[model samples]
Target: MNLTVDIGNTRTKIAVFNGEQFVCEEKFEEAAPQHLLDMVALYSPDKLAYCSVGSGQPAFETALQKLSCPVLHVTGETPAPVTVHYRTPHTLGADRLAAVVGAITLQPETDLLVIDAGTCITYDLVDAAGNYLGGNISPGVEMRLEALHTRTARLPRTEADGETPDLGYDTETAIRAGVVRGIGYELQGCIRHWQKRYPTLRIFLTGGNRYAFSNAVRQNILTDSHLVARGLNHLLEMLP
Candidate 1:
């Protein structure tokens, strides 16, 4: 068995895999290291691959050190199946790269657009030849709503899980619709543009907010919440 941990900006996801087969996954808003330690003790996985884009948790790091199983810390420089082509490779987020790796793992030798709608929405591109061409990041649905409320005076703070119709009726609905639909439009435009370039581009959507925009975006988008975890495990599989 292989264990993969992704400490994202908003939450931490832990997944267990029996080789390439996914077994189970758990998500925590603020991960308790003891709980993770307990899981490690229970699973006794062959390896644990860890990736983080959030603030460092000393407790978790300390706990990781005590674990007997090998823990692989995934970084931008981590050796994966794909070759990253970016000017500032170190600046690239591991989640983004992992998503690309996950896409390739699911559909090898195919042009892919991996979109992760987490704390931030990332759109990463990978060629059919397994090259990570880089991607763009945008504020997530919640972040957009929070920004509007915090930055402005009158606009009320809206949640992503509200009544988001084609057009909003009231202030709250307006904010919700605008933020959600705006992302929909963004996805459509981006997908269309990319499709023009890569005619057979396959779109993969992951992250917490993926379902929120599933209906909004009018495209054939494949979604898997455990994409990053899967990629992390794949990275572990590639290790010498």
Candidate 2:
């Protein structure tokens, strides 16, 4: 069995996998030592892999070291299942690379476009031969909404919720519609442009706000909220 941990800007996810099969998963506001110890006691995993974008807790790392299992802390320089062709490999986000690896693991030897809608919406591509080509990053839903409120004086600070009308009836609704629906259009445009180059492109949507944007875009996409965790598990398999 393998234990995978992904620490994001907002939350941390822990997953247990038996080979390619996912056993269970959990989420925490923070990655604490006790949380990892509890999971270790329950799963008894022989191997562990973790990736962190934030400044991780030292105690958590110590806890992982104490465990009998060999732990692999994934970084931008980590050996991945796919060959990365990005110019600045060292500057690449760990989550972005992990998502690309997870996409390839889920569907090997296929052209893929992975869109992760979390704190920031990231788009990454992998060729059929498993080359990790770089993609773009854009402000996420909440970020956009907050930007409007903070940057401008009149725009109210609104949360993205409820239905977003095509044409908003009032100010709050208009902001909601513009922020939410605009993102949907942006996603569709990106998908269309990419598809023109790669006709057989497969799309994978994952992250916190996946459902919010997935419903807006018109495309055949596979959604997996645990893509990063799954990728960490795949990375564990590649380690020597």
Which lDDT tens digits does candidate 2 get at residues 1-240? 999988888888899999978888999998788899999999899899988887757888888878898999888778987888889988888888888888888889999999999989999998898888899999998899999999998899998997688999999899999988998898999999999989999999999999988777657799999889889899998877
Scored by CA lDDT, what does every candidate get?
A: 0.88, 0.89
lDDT, candidate 1, equals: 0.88
| Local lDDT at 215 for model 2 | 76
In Å, residue 164's CA in model 2 sits off its true spot by 0.7
The number of clashing residue pairs in model 1 is 0
Superposed on all Cα atoms, model 1 deviates from the true structure by an RMSD in Å of: 1.1
Q: Residues 1-240, candidate 1: write the lDDT tens digits.
A: 999988888788899999988899988887679768878888999889888898888888778767888889898888888888988988889888888888788999999999999889999999999888988999998889999999998999887786887888999999999999999899888999999999999999998989887876647789998889889989988888
Best-fitting candidate, measured by lDDT? 2
Clashes (N, CA, C under 3 Å) per candidate:
0, 0
